[model samples]
Target: MEFMMFCRMLVEISFYYSFAGAAAAHFGGGETVLPALLLSVCYILCELLEKHVTAPSAERLQKAGRGESGGAGRFFRYLGLLPAVFWLLLPGMAPADRICFLFPFAYLAAVIWRKDFTLSRYRQTDVFSTFWKAYGIFALTLTIFGGSALLETTVPAALVTVAGSVLLLRALRHGSEVWRHRDYQLRSLFETGLLIAAAWALSRDAVLELLKTVAAAVWNRLLVPVLTVVIVAFSVVFTWLFQLLRYLLTLGHREPQDIGEILQYFTGQGEALTETVVVSDDGSPVWQIVFFVIGILALVILAAVFFRWLLMRAPGEEHAAEQVEKIDHMPPPEDRKAGGIFRNTPAHRIREHYRSYLRCFERQGGTRLPSDTSRELARKTLELAKGTQEGEETLNMHLGRMREIYLRARYRQEVREEDPAEMKRQTSAVKKFLRSRPG
Candidate 1:
């Protein structure tokens, strides 16, 4: 289940990067392909490292230490703000861009300080929220194009639309919480509409620029008005579509390189005059192809979901309800083992239960050091049980015998002359006693 959740987050982050890349291309004049792919790969790798390596190491440090000042604090501080610092320190980052990155880092620090530096306050949702906000900063940094360009192009409008979508999605994602606040939906809708309306105004100017660049032949007294209206309508529709796409792609979760190409696309930095002057009816068809591919991708997702549902069998109601009622009852690893092929071997299962019983011994005041062997731990645990209750004495005797059998099974690789029935009985008795203990 944890692996599945991680995979889902991975997919969502990939889509989010893809969407952000596309938006950057359309509004800020950048290449969407390679940078998006690179960022997605980096994000997934970082997440994998953080979860599997860094987090576990920090947890071990916490276990061996006595205070809140463990590796976890240092990990959170660096993990949360390092990217922001990297972005801000990058050469040629606009002041607004630096501010964008800086604001989030500052806010996170403040929140952490307010919470007494407890990293647990920031959940996965908070991470997603911060990423989206950083995207907004990048989106809004289009003002670097020039104040006039910002007003005349779709950049400002795109910023507003992105902001609205972020807020609206946040509300949707926390619908139950929003429901507790009266007029939350109304306020969100009203704010979103106002931003979109602002976007529509800038979109008209953007359409004019797109028209001048793409279909200059359509520039006549009669058709100019009609073409402008049509292009403006198209821009609005496309903006909304892209916004919806971003929201959907990152519905569960939610980069800047190649500024030179973006600058060229926006400021005509290296373009010949003829390139902008050439009028062709090629725009709509290319857009259609793009939309077609997106539609196909959506259909594939739906099919995947459908097939997944078909393949997964629903648990029986009685078993499902019992599972819910006894949520705290974590059965042994073998009992909850997966039904797939290549199940863990009997030796592996025995090792798991052996470790579990060792943990039980530690809880009962037995000290098992890191250098202690399995046999050593078992012997030390039995020593701790000396002069205890009769029930504990019997349980420890069974545990000692089981440990010897496990040692032989693990190391000797030969069947013992002892009865298999007695071995099974002793193993079961030890497990039953461990589960019955309060700790």
Candidate 2:
């Protein structure tokens, strides 16, 4: 919507100044052409700001580790203020303004390219809100122009009307939080841009005013009334249904992202979720179906009543209720990386756990305990001895037999699991394996 705002603002400036200036320049109105050129400079400033805010990752990598004490702080500071600065500076330099015309075209190109090239990177929450705001302004500006709506409204008044439409656009998008998909953020940027362009064309003044007048005069003024009635019906139906669903979920130990869905449902845009469950090869959904049915029934009765009771209780009661319900949730911090093979994966976690268990035999300088028949730690070391991505694959296999022997020894307990005699021998083997393997 920022782009839309930029476009609309440009169009209006063009309409009053540039169009007039062009006519003036044609009849030797040298003064008029300057304003046209000057308007282009305003566009240039917006583009420069956009680029300064751009997050091209490869370039960002150099600055990523710089922390807060660096040139980045100055760049961000200038990015926010430069557009307004250049907009004010435009009128004085006619030649510069002509050059600046290329700025908007270049920005449009980059925005398009980024939409394709780094599709995932800019998939962020703020993109769409800004897009819709732009769309609404463009749509309104087009409407006024098409209808030949004589500026019966003052220019500032018209700007206000467009601004309000943008706010409404924001409201609609903001209220849509419940139905978002993983790719929703990325796709919204392209879709909103396209839709706003379409809306601008439709709303251009000539088309809409004609359509508006024809429907109003010929159809007994029916469109508005019909729209109102339909809106009312949708609001009542969806609002209650969505709310009840959210209430039940809260009752059943689930939390929702936002509650505005209750309002959106009435807008004739109810959303539904389709989820999946994994079933074994036995091909029986029977157990899953049984559990779902019981859960739903319990959800309806117990959840609803509890929801009402909780709503009526004191605020602290709700906090206490939440504590009673939650078991062992993690703190919302950067406590763990998302992907790793250690703790959460099968083989790696088991290997690491065994190694930690064996750390008791360590002697010095990263060397493990000496070689012995205490095959437990020895086998684990041997398993890992097969080099990683950095090393060769060829290695001994008889120590592999040690895996089985260790498994048997661990179960039989013929020897104490941690006996020093066996530890000495196993540690030696581990040291030998480590010596032979590429470190």
Candidate 3:
């Protein structure tokens, strides 16, 4: 599940970079690498901040049953983007072009930060919906920016989109039991690849031209007019609101001040505030320097505190440890001498015998690491038995038989009627060998 989630995130980030690269290519005269790299860096930073900082804090708060809101953590997360904003500003580009470059990065960051990436919380429909939206944006960007001269940019973007789609499909398939087979996955990929190729071949020229024409028309006829009206209406409303606010601020203080007088007063106050903070003409403001220093210190302090808290064990963990210790010290069931009590179904009986076998092995000083699987443990035991005694083949046979029964019960969810008897026989043979070994 963790692997699948990581793959999904990588696919998302790749699509975002592809779309950003296409837009940067269009606006920056075929220069896509630097802009795409910047966007990718910003995006990855946001994900790290969310995963390591914001998420853990939220989880801890919830666990503690605190009513504290996550607003502060969220604010800090956004604050971390200030350096990226300044980096974008450092480039002397047109305001419109800079905004175009920032839009995809900002949108990607918002999408990633807003969504919880917990595996259990994932929904297939939501993931696919987000993917389609990103793909549409990439296609639109390609259509608008791609021309005969920019085939280099278009080809890379197309390849990235295809790769992302394949990975996302693989993740989807991997999450399901029915479609998890390698052959099934390869078949799906092949079908998707063919579909993408056919679509590209059929729509490479005519469809692209059609889309560009429609986009141009919409921009000229619909978007421009609507934007002009909105700007004009906003200006009028803003002026009215300013006047009302000024009136309220100066109410009963003076008799009907002129608009020019109010503006002059506000400007004077702004200058006063600026002069209070600014200590030099050719350098940054003293307050600005102080603010930067304080922010850095705050970040360092928060990180140290967070790490220290993480190192401390929780009460629940201690309780769980105590419970495990108690279980480890408990006496074995008396039913073990009676060939064990089998209950419920064949699967249950087989599992019970397997557990008994493990306990017996542990009592004989055989350790089972948590990372060892059933088959792995069986192999290790077989190796030990081979080192100690004769009839190695007999011991190997017994272990292999028990391993097969355990695996069938555990994974295949299949237990035949004879599985209980077979499991008992194999387990007894293995345990008998262990009992004969010198302590």
Candidate 4:
């Protein structure tokens, strides 16, 4: 499976280096160029953002001396502004084109958060809400405003925009279905092929414009990753140096005094071993040039080594490792429980909390179930745990997928099907939905 992805990516990349006007000439290069450019720019930006943001954070990780074990992670961490910034800088990109650019970053960020890639995102309502509100506004504009009578006056663009708008809505509503597949790797490859094919379906003029915009966009994304590799390389070198010094210092010395005397001798200049008191005028720094250089170098080197090996090494390497290890070393992803000090995956539990809202088949008495969207009421038990309104529309979008399942489940007809797997997806939607509601 990995090999397949590798081969597919290689093929996609190779078209660049190949004397491949042959392929382009046949398929009509003029058509696909713009989308190819747009996708290429997005692709580059994604990689670069990961590299750059992760690099400095990774350096901090290493300096804190966090080891490779608890790696600085979160697949789509810098999802918010990077893509938007890329789109804004491209003067030629239309608002519609900008949507295409922004959508993927937002989508990827949600997906990563969903997968529990970084911190368990339960209390992370702020992160989830901010990104989706932007997305929801974009969606609202595309679907509602784009479909308005005045906008529809532009016939061809209206037609294209309307089609894209409808598909985006459908795609988002059933997004988890698309993301969750047994052969997800294969599916992603297939989707890329389809996108590339769609690129070919464009008009020549549109293609050229997209290509230029995409080129600029791709360049923007490249900056981040390039920075990441540089930072990692530097931190690793520093670690190596610090570790080496520790080895040398500890090789023979038995006590702190022994090491300290040796360190002073090694750091001090050979000249002026006499105790004649070098005329201290109440301690203004008289530059004993050789000693000063030696002292400064020793202090810098010692501090660096101490930080890398002592204070930082313990936490950066051993400490962070133990914390992550407890979670990863759990019996299985399924066997793990909801609560543990170091076990941070509350995304599932948060989902379950929200799903309990759905069990109320219309309450009867004073003990009736609370309205799912009632923020004030929900605040009594769950301060921040409220979900989006379980209005028929939201439920229909989330829990109802198949026509048969909807009919059977809706009418209370006896039904025996496997339990739904979308509790997590529902939870994420609830998080996104409630975020729209106030405290």
lDDT of 1 by residue, 121-153 (tens): 112222344445644564456556543343233
- For residues 34-73, could you state the per-residue lDDT of candidate 4 as single tens digits? 4323434444444444445644576677788775324335
Q: Note the clash tally of each candidate.
A: 1, 23, 0, 12
- Candidate 3 structure quality by residue, lDDT tens digits, 400-436: 8899988877666665547889999999999888877
By descending lDDT, how would the candidates be arranged? 3, 1, 2, 4
Off by over 4 Å in 4: 1-44, 47-87, 91-184, 199-439
Which parts of model 1 are misplaced by more than 4 Å? 1-50, 53-55, 61-73, 93-101, 108-148, 152-439
Mind sharing the TM-score for model 2?
Answer: 0.21
Global Cα lDDT for candidate 4: 0.37
* Candidate 2 Cα misplacement greater than 4 A, ranges: 1-73, 76-180, 186-191, 202-205, 212-216, 219-439
Indicate the worst ten consecutive residues by lDDT in candidate 4.
306-315
Would you give me the overall lDDT of model 2?
0.38
**lDDT of all predictions:** 0.45, 0.38, 0.55, 0.37
TM-score of 3: 0.31
Per-residue lDDT tens digits of candidate 2, residues 1-439? 2332333333333333222222222323223222322333344443444344433332465577733334553244234334444553566544423333333333333332222111110111122233345434644674666622322212222333344334323423332342144465455556445544443444344755676688667666676778888999999999899888999988888776545565566554423322234444765799878876785465346324422321221122223323321211111111221232212222222234345435632522244446644454544554556664323222234344334434433443222223333434443454455556555
RMSD versus native structure for model 4: 28.5
Error of 4 at 134 (Å): 16
lDDT of 1 at 175: 27
**TM-score of every candidate relative to the true structure:** 0.24, 0.21, 0.31, 0.23
**TM-score of the candidate numbered 1?**
0.24
